[model samples]
Target: MSYEVTGKLVAKYDTVQRTETFKTREFVIEKSDDIGGRIINNYVKFQCVQDKTALPDKFNIGDDIKVSFNLKGTKWSKDGRENYITNLDAWRLEAAGSLAQTAINNAPDNFVPDAAPDDVVDDLPF
Candidate 1:
């Protein structure tokens, strides 16, 4: 199952190895304003497979983001201690905006090149 969530980017950490077999990244995103009440003071850490290509190049601490992910949980036995964990495996991420396109257009004009630099000064390849 999948769901959408919007929160503040509280932390971004380097990738970590899980069980040496599954590698993942951990990042803390705090719930600021959502259906969940009084979550602003509580932060939730999500573990996901690091996909550098999918992350925003300009994301920084305190930035707000909207993510789409799947809620996952795990349970394991640990010498009589019950080990349980839960996290959201984010599959999609984007700057928080009223609409997706608005974030793109509102970004710095040079945020990403639409055409080659030569095309800007020389002949149109069209």
Candidate 2:
């Protein structure tokens, strides 16, 4: 299943790949105000693919962003102990600007779902 997260752009960097095809950025999102603004205080990072047309040019540090990402799962095992990890693989990063950050949460048309798969039920059915 694909998920979208709205946050702020806290950092940005590009990975070297000949012509620099890989680029990733981190953002800070206010997950919830009710949690005393703790969740939103964390630095959540998102990634942008090689496509230059994926996002607008307004994306900058300290700007509010709404990121759409894919949920990627990972596993770790060490010293007879195993653990699972998951990360948000960002596919699209949108900067909503500071003025629009508050309005984005309530904006009904902010989320746009194109052609996507349905029923992403895992075979393990966790």
Highest lDDT among the candidates is held by which one?
1
Q: Estimate, for each residue in 17-60, the C-alpha lDDT of model 1 and write its tens digit.
A: 66666677767778865455543466877666856323633577
- Candidate 2, which ten residues in sequence have the lowest lDDT sum? 25-34
Each model's lDDT comes to 0.71, 0.59
TM-score of each: 0.63, 0.50
Best by TM-score: 1
lDDT of 2 at 10: 61
Error of 2 at 49 (Å): 4.3
Candidate 2, residues 57-122: lDDT per residue as tens digits?
A: 556666766777788879999999999987666666665656466556666763533425563434
User: Which residue runs of candidate 2 sit more than 4 Å off their true CA positions?
Assistant: 16-32, 36-40, 49-58, 76-85, 97-126
Inter-residue clash pairs, candidate 2: 30-40
**Which regions in candidate 1 have their CA more than 4 angstroms from the true location?**
19-21, 34-40, 50-58, 98-102, 106-126
For candidate 1, give the lDDT of residue 46.
69
